[model samples]
Target: MKKFAVGIVSAAFILGAGTAVFAAGTNNSDNGFSFEKMLPFMQKMHPDQPSRN
Candidate 1:
């Protein structure tokens, strides 16, 4: 019984950790960048896109 409880707890922890890692990369702006900083890189990489400014 003790081993079973420990196995359940370990599985929960592993699943929770896996979810947290997956969530970290889902948001593109996770690092927090502003338009001013992002615009130049975007413009250089994608010259075809019309700049809103």
Candidate 2:
């Protein structure tokens, strides 16, 4: 029982740490990748093809 409890706590701590790191990484807006910047180029390359879905 004690081992199980320790395992659960450790798993939770690791998950929480990973989530915090991910959140911190995503907080930076200037990661150099932007879809809005590339939109015009994409539009020029693929002009309004009807979706074949």
The TM-score leader among the candidates is 2
User: What stretches of model 2 exceed 4 Å from their correct place?
Assistant: 32-53
Per-model TM-score, in order, reads 0.51, 0.56
Residue-pair clashes, model 1: 0
Tens-digit per-residue lDDT, 1-53, candidate 2: 99999999999999999999987776555786466666667778888855343
Please count the clashing residue pairs in each candidate, in the order shown.
0, 0
List the candidate 1 regions with Cα displacement exceeding 4 Å: 29-53
What are the Cα lDDT values of the candidates? 0.84, 0.79
Residue by residue across 6-52, what tens digits does model 1's lDDT show?
A: 99999999999999998876566646775666888989999998877
Colliding pairs, model 1: none
Q: 24, model 2: CA deviation in Å?
A: 0.6
